[model samples]
Structure formats: structure tokens, C-alpha cells
Target: MKKLKIGIIGCGSIAKHRHMPEYHASSGAVIAAVCDINEERANVFAGLYGAEVYTDYRELLANKDIDAVSVCTPNYLHAPISAAALNAGKHVLCEKPMATSMEEAKDMIEAASKNGKKLMIAHNQRFVPSHKKAKELIAEGEAGKIYSFRTVFGHGGPEGWSADGKESWFFKKNQAFIGAMGDLGVHKTDLLRYLLGEEFTEVGAFVETSAKIDADVDDTAVCVLKTESGVIGTLAASWSYVSKEDNSTIIYGEKAILRLEDDPVHSLIVQYANDDTVKYELGGIQTNEEGGQKNSGVIDHFLESILNEQEPAIPGSEGMKSLQVILAALEASETKQIVRIN
Candidate 1:
């Protein structure tokens, strides 16, 4: 079997910690090229992988030997870069919140369709062991009609995790677009949609830049979401979590209450109304913290999809659905009204 040649387009924290490492570990893929505006950073990764280095993404996209590319660039560049790569006949694995706007997301999807190449959004929450098990239990009717949920993903701002530290583009509105809502909220929205197999139809939110005094983007967001099936829930994303990162979800159902990533030892716990308890000691979700370096399973999945000529698990359309919810939430926050999704 021919190994897929991958070109990484960003040398940021995500690219360094997730894409590069995972691609290097994969038997079906090899890093054939790397690109970053910062040639020094790109060179570092290039040397590690023995891949070509380019300051311009277009030049990397022009490489005929590259089968696919991972768009790990800032949020603002996702759509254009992915579109360009797709048009260049390379499959794309883009980071989530796939685009800054619905129009951009639509354009990305159209590019993938027009090029006949797979366009996958790196929404890796679905691949977490605990999350996957939770989805299975919910699908098996063990939860028995989820009534409400509260999912939160909070960390101490991207300044510490980003490659450029305090000078990272994550703090700029023009670069990151919507801050925590895009950085963390979209992941939960995607997870909710995947776990419950339902679409969020309405959203009400409060998005603010309560912390990070120098930042232009929002640092905190809280949203109330209504699914098409009428399941209501709250979602919170924040860069203001000072003490420790909190990535947890609690789902209340008729038969049981499901707690995810709430305990240090157990990744998931289900407590039934009948006084029975089930705990899953599934491994931790990947994080930026030390020793939290679990494989995200995204690169492997993308390679498999391309090799098998099948649609990706999280296609551009699915990414748009999740992005639509976040975009609607942003509007709701600004207008102080519940925005309905079309």
C-alpha cells in the first residue's frame, strides 16, 4: 500500500502536538512537506520529518506528490487555504471551527465537491474513547431520552499553548474571529450533535471578553441551545479558567445521568434512576498539558478515508452544521435574542 503524502500548512501548537506527531506515527501516511509564514518554525518540523519546507502554502499545494494536506492555520485562513488545496487536487483535513463564516464554510464544501476530494474537519471529540462509548450508550437507548445537558470546555487562554505565546493570533478578533466560542464551544456543539444524533435548531448566548485584558476577542461564552427534538442544554466555553482546564459534560436523562470527564479516574459515569451505577475507565481526552499527549485519531481516519475513497467521518457539511450553531450563538449574544438556525 502506498503511504499518503501529507503536507502540514501550519507550525502552530496544534500542528506540532497533534497533526505532525500523529502523522509521523501513522503507517499509512508521511509528512512530505510543511509550510508556515515563520520559516524557522516550518524548518524545525521539516527537519524532524525530512520534508520539504515552504513559506507559501500555495507552493506546498502545488506539490503533485502530496496526496493531502492539513490546514492548521489560523481560523481566518481555513476556508481559502482548504479551497486552494482542494482545487489543487489534494484532500484536506481542516482544524475546527472550520471557517469564520457560513459563506466560507459553504465555499469549502463546494470546493471539496467540485474537486472530488475528501474534506474533513478535525473535530476529534467524537474519537475520544469515553465520548465514543457515551455515544454508543445513548444510541442504545441506555440514557432513555436525554432531557438536558451542560457541556463546558475551558482552559487558561491560548496564549500559553500557542506557538507564539502572548503574541499569538488567537487573541486577535480578525485572526481568531469569535474566541472561546470558536475555540472550545464548537467542539461541544459538534459532540452534542454527534452524541444525540440531533441538530441544534435555536441558540441564545452571552459572549464576552471578561478576562484577558489585552485581547480583542471574546474570552468567555455561555449558550443555551435547543435541539430540533426539543432537547435543551447549556454550553459554556471559556479562556478564563485560571486554575485548571475543565472539559466535562453532564447529561440528564429519564433513566440515568451521564457524567463525562468529571472525575480524574473515570472518564465517564452513568448513574441510573434505579440506583445502579456504571463507570467507564476509558483513557483521557487529548490535551495540551504534559503527559496528555494521546493520539487524536484524526490523521489516521483522514488517511483511511482517502485510501478507501470514502467520505470522512466529519465532512465539511458536518463542520458547517457545528459552525452554524456557533455562528448563531454569536449573533444571539450580540442581539440579545434567541437566534433560530435555518
Candidate 2:
């Protein structure tokens, strides 16, 4: 099989920490190019991966040698760049909250369909060991009928994770768009939908920027979501958890409650109503802390889908469904009404 020549757009922290490194490690892919508005950062990745560097993503996309591209740019650029890459005849693995708006998300899907290219959203939470196990147990009815769930994804802030540190685009409303909701909440929305195999139909939210000083976007958000099957849940995404990160989820069911990524040793725990308990030592959730693990199986899956001529597990339509929930949450928070997904 010919190696997939991958170009990375946005040589930011996520690209540096996740996409670039994971692609470099993949046996079926090669880092053909790297692009960032900041030439220095792009050059750094280019030097590390022995790939060409570009300041403009369009230039990188125009490279006929690049078979695929990863859009690790900000939330606002995800749609445009991925759409452009797809139109340029390259498969796209885009970082999530697929786009800033529903329209842009749809455009991305159309672009992929029109160009006959694959478009996959990098919602890596689905690949996490604990998350994958939770999905399996729920699908097999081991969780017995899921009643409700509460999932949270929080940490210090993007200031600690972005390449520009405190000056990252994540704090800017125009760039990051919806703050923690886009950065963290969307992950939960996608995960819960994947786990339960249902799409969210309605949302109510409380979004605020109380934690991050001078930040234009929300730092904390709590959204109440209801799936088509009547499974209700609360999703909390925050950039204010200064003490420690809380990337955990609890699914309450008729038979048991499954807690994922909530413990230090066991990554998943199931406690039955009859007092029987099961512990699963899958592995810790991925984080950007000092020694945190970063690989999330996104690049591998993208390359495999291309190599096998199969659609990605999380295609643009699936990503749009998740993004719609978040967009509805934002609308609900703004209009003070329960927003329904169409």
C-alpha cells in the first residue's frame, strides 16, 4: 500500500501534541507538509517531521503530492480549510466542533460529497479506552436501560494548552467561537451520542465567562440535553477547573451506574443497584498535563479508512449532528428557550 502523504494545517498545540506526532508514528502515513500562519511554528514542525512548511494552508492544500490533510486550526477555520482541502481532492480529518455554524458544517459535508473525498471529524473521545468500553456495555444492554448521564470535560484553560499560551486564539470569541462548549462540551455531546447510539433532539444551556478574566468567550457552560430516545443528560464544560482536570462521565441506568475516567486507578467503574461492583482498569483519559498521554487513534482511523476505501466511523454528517447539539445549546442560552434540533 502506498503511504498516505498527510499535510497538517495549523501547527498549534493540538497539531504539535496530537495530530503531527500521531501521524509521524503511523506506519501508513507520512507527514508531507505542515502549515500555520505563524511560519516559525510551522517551520518547527517541518524540521521535526522532515516535511515542507507553509504559512498559508491553501498553499499546502494545493500540493498535489499531499493525499490528505488534518485541520488542526481554530474552530472558525475548520470548515473553510477542510472544505477547501476536500475540494482540492484531499481527504480531511478535521478537529472538532466541526464548524462554527451549522451552515459551514453542511458546506463541509457537501464539499466532501461533491469531491468524492473523505471527511472525518477528530472527535477522539470515541477512541478512548474507557469511553469505548462504556459504549459497548451500553450497546449490549449491560447497563440495562440508561436513565440519565452527566459528563464533564474541564481543565485549567486553553492558556495552559495552546501554543501561544495565554494569548491563544481559544480565548477570542471570533476565533474559538463558543469557548469551553466547543472545546470540551462538544466532545461529551459526541461521546454520549456514540455511546447511546442516539441523537440529541433538544438542548437548554447556561453559558458564562465568569472564570477567565478578560476572555471574550465563555469559560464555563452547562447544557441539558435530551436524546431522541428520551435519554436526558447534563453536560458541563469548563475552563475553570484550576485544581485538577475532570474528564469524567456517569451513566445511570436501571441495572447499574457506569463511572468513566473518574478514578485514579480504574478508568471505568460499574456499581449495580444490588451492591455488586465491577472495576475496569482500561487507562487514564488523555490530557495535556506534564506527562499526559496524547495519542487518541484519530490519525490511524483516518488513514485506515482511506487505505481501505471505507467511510470514516465519524463522518461529516455524524460530526454535524454533534455540532448541532452545541449550536442549539448556544441558541438556548441566548434566547432563554429550549432549542430543538431540526
Candidate 3:
């Protein structure tokens, strides 16, 4: 099989940790080009992969040999870059919050549709071992008729994980847009939708900037979301966990309560109504901590979809659906009213 030539835009932390390494390791794909506003960073990655380097993403996109690209830029650039790559006759694997606005997301989807190319969002939570196992358990009736859930994804902040500590685009409203809500909230939103097989119908939230006072974006958010099936849940995303990270989700069901990523030894645990408990040591969820570079299975999945001409697991449409929930949460916080997802 001929390897797909992949160009990487924005050679930052995500591109370094997830996209570049995974693509470089894959036999089905090759990192043929690298782009970043910083020429030095682009040169470093390009040298490692023995690929072309471009300081401007547009010039990289213009390359005819590149078959696809991973848009690893800030949240605001996701849509425009992905759309441009799609229109350039290249498939796109964009980092999530896919876009900062619904209109932008729609445009990206439209571009992919018009260009007959794939557009996959890198919502790595869906690829987590515990999340995958929980989805299977719920589908198999282990967690019967789930009624509610409380999912949280909180960390100290992006200062350490970002390439530019304390000065990354993550703190800028123009670049990051919604901060933790967009960065961390959207992951859980997409994960819940994937696990429940339903879209969120309503949202009430309190999105604020209680931490990182100097930043112009929200550092904390707590949303009450109601699914189409009338199941309700609380979703919280925060960058104020000054000590440790809390990436956990607990689902309450009729037959049992399923806990995911809440325990150190066990990744998942099901406590049945009959007082019986079952634990599964699936694996640890990915984090920004040291030694957290687990294979996300996202780049491989993207390559498989393009190579086999199959629909991507999380297409632009799917990403838009998840983005809608976060958008509604933002609206709810602004208006102080429960916003309905249409």
C-alpha cells in the first residue's frame, strides 16, 4: 500500500505529541510536510521526519504531493484551515473544539462535502480505553437505562502542556475563544454523545473566569445538560485544579452505576443494584502529565478512513453536533437561562 503523504499545520504541543509521532510511526502514512509560524519549530519537526518545511500554512497547503493534513492550530483556526485543506483536495484531521463558532463548523463541513474529502475531529476521549469499555458495557445492558451522569475534566491549566508556557494562545480570547469550555468541555460533550448515542437537547451553565485572572477567557465552566432521551447530567471543565487533574465520569443507571477513570487502580467499575461490584483495569486515560503520551488511535483511524474510503468515525458533521452542545452552554451562561439545542 502506498503511504499517504500528510502535512502538519501548527507544529505545537498537540502536533508534537499526538499527530506527528503517530503519523510518523504509521506504515500507512508519512509526514511529508510541516508548517508553523515559527520557522525554527517547523524546521525541527521537518528535519525529524525528513519532510518539507513551511512558515506559512497556505504554502504548505499548496503542495501537490500532500494528500492530507492535521490542523493543530489554535481553536479559532480549526475551521478556516480545515476548510482550506479540504478545498485543496486534501483530507483533514482537525484538532477539537473543531471550531469556535457554529457557522465556521458548518463551513468546514460544507467544504469537505463539496471537495469529496474526509474531515475528522481529534476528540481523543472517544479513543480512551475506559471510555470505549464503558460504551460497550452500556450498550450491553450493564448500565441499564442510564438516568444521569457527572463528567469532569479539570487540570492545573495549559501553561505546562502548551509549547509556550504561560504565554500560549490558550489564554487569549481571540485565539482560544472559550478557554477551558472549548479545550476540555467539548471533549466530554463529544464523549457523552458517543457513549449515549443521543444528542444534547438543553443546557444551563455557569461559565466564568474564576481562575487565571490575567487571561481574557473563561477558566471554569459547569453545565447542566439534558439529552434527547430525557437523561440529565452535569459537565464541568476547569483549569483551576491547582494540584491534580480530575478526568472522571460517573453514570447512574437503573441496574448499576458505572464509574470511569475515577479510580487509580481500576479504570472502570460497575456497582450493581444488588450490591455487587465489578472492576476493569482497561488502561489509564491520557493526560498532560509526564509519560502521558499514550497512542490516541486518532491519527491511525484518520489514515484508515482515507485509505479505505470509509466515512470517518467523527466527521465534520459529528464534530458540529458536539460543538453545538458547547455553543448552547455558552449561550446559557450568557443569558442565565436554559438554552435548548435545536
Candidate 4:
């Protein structure tokens, strides 16, 4: 089979560490072109990935050989870039949050359907092995009926990746729209949605800025979610965690309590009502290209979807639903009342 030629727009941290590396690892895909506002950065990324570089994504999109494009730009550009890629007859794999607004997300979905191209979102959390198995167990009634749960995806500010720490565009309302909510918050939102298999009905949130004083965007976000299945839960995320990682989720069911914690070992710990605890140690969660906390299984599976012409695990519409939960959380924080997720 001929390699699927891929173009990467916005050669930033995510494009560098996740998408580009995953594409490099895929025998069925090749990095054919790259685009970024910074010509030097684009050139460096293209050279490193063995691909051609373009300052404007428009030029790169003109290449007929490029079968797909990954939009790794800021939240604001996600919709427009993905739309353009789809219009140009290329499959789109957009980085998460889908878009800055619900309307933008709808537009992205419309573009995908109209162009008849595959549209997938990079929600890597849903691809975690432990998380997947946990969902499976819950669905199979192995954990009984879920009572409550909590999910958190937090980390220090993107100072390591951003040009400016708190002063970065990510901290700005215009560049990012929402701070930690859009960054880390969206991941947990997607994770919760994936785990529970239900849409959020309403959200009550207390979102604020704590660590990054210069940031006007909220660095800490704590949200209360009411699911359509009548499940009440909390979705907490922040860019202010002090080194200690806390990407965890716990679901308390009638028969057992399921626990999934991040890194150093991603496992499924089930504690029964009688206090008998069981452990399922999962060692092979990520693909070969993954490093550190970066899981490449999602990207590899996406490539496989393109190759097989199958629906991606996380489609554009499903990603929009996750964004809706985040939007509701933002609204809840702004209004200081429960906002319905619709």
C-alpha cells in the first residue's frame, strides 16, 4: 500500500511531540508538508521530519498528494484551518477543544460532512488502555451501577512549551479564549464523557486564576457535572499543579469502586463492597512512538482508520459534545449557576 501523504499545519509543541512523531512511526503515512507562521520553525520541523515546509498553510493545502492535514494551531484557529483542509479535499485530524465556540464546532462538523472527508479529534485520554478497559468493565456490568465519579487532568503551566509562561497567548483570552479549561480541562471532559457514555446535562463551576498571576485566563477550574444518566460528578483541571501528576478517575458502583490513576503504572483497581480489592495491571497502553506521558496509540489508530476507511474512535461530532461540556463549565463559572450542556 502506498503511504498516505500528510500535511501538518501550525508546527507547535503538539505537532512536534505527538502528531509528527506518530506520523513518522506509521509505515502507512508520510509527512509530506508542514506549515507555520514562523518560517524558521517550520523549516526546522520540516527538516527534522523529512518533509517540505511552507509559511502559509494555503500553499501546503494545494498539494494534491497530501491526503490529510493535522491542525495543531491555537484554539481559535482550529475550526478555520480544519474547515479549509476539509474543503481542500483532505481528511482532518484536529487537536482538541474542537473550536473556541460551539458555533465554530458546528461549522467544523458541517464542513466535514459537506466535503465528505474524515474528521477526527486528537483526544488521547480516551485511548488510554486502563481507561478503555475500565469503560468496558463498566459497560459489561462488571463494576455494577455507577454511583459517582471524579476526573482530574492537571499540570503546571505550558511554560516549558509556550514562548511565555503566564504571558503566553494561551494565558490571553483572545488567543486561547479559555485557559486551563480549554487546555487540560477539555481532556478530562472528554475522558468523563468517554468513561460514562453519557452527555453532560448541566455544569456548575468555580474557575479562577491562582498560580499564574499574570494570566487573566483561569488557571484553576473545578466543575460539577450532572450527566443525562442522572450521574453527578466533578471535572477538575488546572495548569497550576506543582509537579505532582493527578490524572485520575474513580467510579463508585453498587458492587465495586473502580480506580484509574496516571503514570508510573496505569492500572485498574477495583474494590468490592466487602473490601476485597482486585488489580488489573496493564503495561501495553501506548504505541511504540510514545514517550513520557504522550500516548501515541490514538494517533496510530487514527492512521489505521484512514487506511481502513473506518470511522475514527473519536469523530468530529463526538469531539463537539466534549467541547459542549467544557463550554457549559465556562458558562457555569461566568454565570455562577448551573449551565445546561446542549
Candidate 3 worst ten-residue window by lDDT: 286-295
The segments of candidate 4 whose C-alpha lies over 4 angstroms from its true place after superposition are: 163-167, 262-266, 284-295
lDDT of 4 by residue, 214-236 (tens): 88788899999888888888888
Least well predicted 10-residue stretch by lDDT in candidate 2: 286-295
Candidate 1 total steric clashes: 0
Task: For candidate 2, write residues 318-341 as lDDT tens digits.
Answer: 999999999899999999999999
What lDDT does model 4 reach?
A: 0.84
| Predicted candidate 3 versus true structure: per-residue lDDT over 1-342, tens digit per residue | 899999999999999988988998899999999999999999999899999999988999999999999999998899999999999999999999999888999999999999999999999999899999999999999888999999999999999899998999999999998899999999999999998989999999999999899999999999999998999999999999998799999999999999999999899999999999999999789888853578889999999999999999999999999999999999999999999999
Off by over 4 Å in 3: none
Error of 2 at 227 (Å): 1.4
* TM of each candidate vs. truth: 0.99, 0.98, 0.99, 0.95
Question: What tens-digit string does per-residue lDDT give for candidate 1 at 220-324?
Answer: 999999999999999999999998789999989999999999998999999999999999999887787763368888988999999999999999999999999
Model 3's alpha-carbon lDDT is 0.94
Off by over 4 Å in 2: 290-292
Model 3's TM-score against the true structure: 0.99
Q: Candidate 1: where is the Cα deviation over 4 Å?
A: none
Note the clash tally of each candidate. Answer: 0, 0, 0, 0
**Candidate 4, after superposition: displacement of residue 249 in Å?**
0.8
